[model samples]
Target chain A: MKTLWSGSREGSLLRYRAMAFTVGTGLLLLVFVGIPIQIWGHSKAVVAVVGPIHGYLYLIYLAAAFDLARRERFPISRLFVMISAGLVPFVAFIIEHRIVASLRAEERSDATAS
Target chain B: MNRESDRQVRWVAPRALVAHLLVLCFVPGCLIAGWWQATVAMSGNGLSYLYAFEWPVFAIFSVVLWWNFLHDDPDEVGGRRLRELRRDESISGERAELRSPDFRTEDEDDELRAYNDYLAQLAQRDRAKGWRSR
Candidate 1:
């Protein structure tokens, strides 16, 4: 179609990366910083603030992952893994890194072939 | 994979079967929790009533996700049609069409299939035009 991607896929990739970074940071702070401070430091402050932020960021992460997965035609299982990656600490970072590297490689090959 | 072959594979695949079984169990668990909360709400518990609605929404969301997983097309992982739809909407300034429909109907899936077919036709025409111009 005349309007299809306007010959670009970079937009989705950029959006996905931004969301992944945000979610990953939020998750790390909640899991490592917030939880530890709440438990040992006897402070509810970190948990009180970080908990809701992490929850909301996770929801947005799910949406972002879904959008990217749809654009990339990711298999449902892969999509699930991408979505779940936001739930655990460090997983989002690893998955995002791999996704960026693989996509870049594919784009390079596509450009060469075309 | 084609629909029939996909279905056959899913049927034989242990992981798929396990996933489906988990979904079946999870849905009923959500429903039962909803029902329990609803009953508690009848006794005038305000928070329980809120939870009653939440549980069913969770169940519905799970079912929708499961259905999408089951029916997902292996070939469309490239999201070509989706990108086209977004681009067309952007150019036409017609974002309303992409918004959720106002009314749900039994034939919603059929309508979506028809829309995809239309998009595919437009894509094919565009490809032909591009070839001619080149």
Candidate 2:
């Protein structure tokens, strides 16, 4: 099937990474810069704007993560962890790093076996 | 998808039990959270309206993910790749994974056995002719 990815493992991984960071940054801004300022500064402006943007970006993040998980065939438990990582702060960045490390390790093993 | 009864669907399996629990608890949790957001939206919080919609979508996503997980065989996905890279010299990941055998559907296992047998016959015939790919 035609997808955002070019049917290459590398392409999907790259896409997932890009989405993770984009979503991560969106969440960070919403939590730190947006919500805090809105609370103390008596402004609905930042939360009103950043809130929906982060919400929509999260949907994209879910799609990207699902695509990468399908390509990689990650264990269901691991996939659950990856999904949860998006809901919490700073977890997506850590999970993404771990996923990259594991993927590299798998590639190394595949190279040796082949 | 139209396979026979050879592949048993393991609904009560340990992993499936966990998945069932997750679906039961998570779906309601999301709907309730959505309800709370709806109330907040009614109170004039515009952003809460978007959140109210998003929560139900999250619930739907969880159900889909749970179904896929229920039907999944942990390592039988050929490493979960959507497609094999078809290069002349490439060895499929399944063949390369000698560590542990994945439990595939009976139909697929039989097909794989037949294919391997065909390859073996070709190799034997090639050796008998005293030349390879000539």
Candidate 3:
């Protein structure tokens, strides 16, 4: 199990994973922590602070994920799902894990065979 | 524009229809959302401004993607039927890259010699495989 933080390797997945985690945590904060406060508690502080940050992080996540997806030759449908993972809370994290595992499984024996 | 480019820009293909409908719904929807967010921001939820600005960008991005899908050629770069799946693609792609003539073959070092030998072996194996297939 390669923990996301344990390796600083510059593989294609690393940047996308980092962005996914960043955007995922930001979204979790915005939805679970921020929006609830805004709605029920009548406070905009958390949403104000976290929302823009999430917006920008989502942008970076989009670019990173798109680049990696093309490199890995993912189908268009998977690319759309990857794009949407940013907007849905916790989905980014789930998709990130899927991406990492998929890429590893792909390259495992194949990497050395070359 | 040429007739071929005209055919590509037509929006009747099933995938093209999907893209067309999405852009139809998405761009105006984003704008409306942006306007609504502007009202929310005006009412003092300062963070609503983020979405106010963001929605328009999303609308633009969708248009860009839609435009791309309209003109995409399945065999061309960025035009490969992106969602089309084929097993062994990863293996075949990597193999092609390894055999592509980017590496120096004639350097005097032992590694280069070995690489040249490896390339020769790959070529021989490929020729054999081609013969076998035929």
Best by TM-score: 2
Clashing pairs in 2: none
Residue-level lDDT of model 2, residues A1-114, one tens digit each, is 344467788878888888889888888888889888988988878888888888888887887788788667876656777777888889889888888876775576567657
Instruction: Name the lDDT of candidate 2.
Output: 0.73
Ranking by lDDT: 2, 3, 1
Candidate 1 segments whose C-alpha is farther than 4 A from its true place? A1-8, B1-16, B27-61, B77-134
Candidate RMSDs in Å, in order, are: 19.5, 14.7, 13.4
lDDT of 1 by residue, B78-117 (tens): 4644443444444334323443364333565987778866
Question: Candidate 1 — which pairs collide?
Answer: A72-B77, A73-B77
- Per-residue lDDT for B1-134 in model 2, tens only? 34423567789988789889989999999999999999999999877999999999989989988877766664466434322223211333334354225332355667787876676565445433310112
**Candidate 3 CAPRI-style tier:** incorrect
Each candidate's DockQ: 0.09, 0.20, 0.10
- Give the lDDT of residue A19 in candidate 1: 83
Query: Which portions of model 2 show Cα errors greater than 4 Å?
Result: A1-4, B2-6, B74-134
Candidate 2 vs candidate 3: the DockQ winner is: 2
**CA-based DockQ, model 1:** 0.09
Model 3: colliding residue pairs: A75-B82, A75-B83, A76-B82, A76-B83
Q: Estimate each model's TM-score.
A: 0.56, 0.70, 0.64
True contacts kept of each: 0.19, 0.38, 0.15
Q: Which of the numbered candidates is closest to the native, going by highest lDDT?
A: 2
